[model samples]
Target: MVTKWVLLPVPAQDADSIELDIAERQRKRGEPTSPSAGELSDDELASEMLRRTTFGAFIPWPESALERLAAATTETTRRWSIVMTLCAESPGTLFSTTDISERTELTIGEWRTACRHITPHLRKHYKDAPLWGPGLYEGSTEWPLVTMSGRQLKLRHELHVGITEEQAKRWRAVLNRTTQNVA
Candidate 1:
């Protein structure tokens, strides 16, 4: 498993209801409506969300990695929908590109085009450890956050091993519904 993971800026509220629940609790307590609004950094908020929802409190995933996963779930982009679909479907399991394409009901060409859009972003945002080599110009057919080997794609090992079965089902429900909005 690769130890280096991409980091994203902010935590996404869509991945779980914890933030909303917290906000409600605050309301009951007559506290501010925004939970931890300025108190926690983007990385901290992301870590808190993942700890409370997807992974248990003990998973050692770095804050940035957590933010990355949160961002993946929250994005409305076609490329992100592809990633969310793959992760939601397989989690830690390996699935082929063909499998993901069939699941998305996208032709291989469309799938490839979606993947192409992710490369520049990944290359720009994660230059320190380039997620899928340096660039698409190098003939990389891999995704930004997803781990790829030939045609086999899997969620990052941390996500695969860290996310529980029940949590995965929640993620599947959220991701599957969001994926439908891509078209």
Candidate 2:
């Protein structure tokens, strides 16, 4: 007998809650709120929101490689849903080439090349902010772990809610399979 293993990356923290909040807001308000506000004009607000939401956490990657991999891999509906939810919730928290290589058991070089392939698409679609200059974010240059205000918190909450629902679905499926085997 052979055992097959499937490796799925765990959803980031608060993914479900954030998704729920976003969905609810869209339903009730009919307008998505900006992720953050920091005393700026309209243009500045747009730029800042784009920067904060789009690519704050994740490392940049190339486009072609990502496309090939996304095409080749057979992602389940659940996985795709999770990915979409993640992108909506926090587009900035992307995996770097190195991070992807390490997590997915791919070679660093391969991951880097793939990242290069996908990056252009990400840039074009996501419109991430420019890289932070030296001495930003409490003088450490790292992405801030905490959201800046209540609005950001609400968005994050919705993302987590969506993640939770997905997790519950997965867990229930596992339980059902186990029970069927036992019977």
Candidate 3:
């Protein structure tokens, strides 16, 4: 089974409150919130939800989503390490290959090669129904202007393309869970 660790920005102690706050805000705005505020706390809870509730199988790391992701694949190890480092430097914006290379000492060519190596795996595990067009990769734009949504969408399109219906459903569940956690 593929496993991935994601470094959720929400701290364990703050997760519950954040969820509540989001729910309250949604209610006030009359907008729907994906996974109600009472849904999760910490990476363990998120992983439990992903396993017991979604994929019906246990993933290896739950202490921190990033830890699980780190253990999932050697290729992902490099990609996520770079991603986390980029996130640390820039909180909400996307980072291009040049930005990552310049910031992390991975050359632009090296970054592209690493991304290409991991693209198939990311597509296989994380892609859901194409909400948008085909997903975007590092070399799509000028270099440093790709957004998170673009990368994720591209991965999802690659994964779901020609997949069995049942597999798609399961994949969608995983995607939804991820969306919830990120939100």
lDDT of each: 0.44, 0.36, 0.42
Give one digit per residue, the lDDT tens place, for model 3 in 55-120.
Answer: 222121222333334344666555655554354343333445555666776676766676566545
Sort all candidates by lDDT, best to worst: 1, 3, 2
For model 1, the stretches where C-alpha displacement exceeds 4 angstroms are 1-76, 124-144, 151-183
lDDT of 3 at 3: 26
- Alpha carbon lDDT at 180, candidate 1: 72
* Cα RMSD for predicted model 3: 17.1
Q: Candidates ranked by TM-score, best first?
A: 1, 3, 2
| Local accuracy of candidate 1 as per-residue lDDT tens digits, 107-167 | 6566566555655655545343323334454443233233334311122222112233443
Q: After aligning candidate 2 to the native by TM-score, how far in Å is the CA of 154 from where it should be?
A: 25
User: Stretches of candidate 2 above 4 Å error?
Assistant: 1-70, 73-92, 117-183
Q: What are the runs in model 3 whose C-alpha is more than 4 Å off?
A: 1-65, 125-183
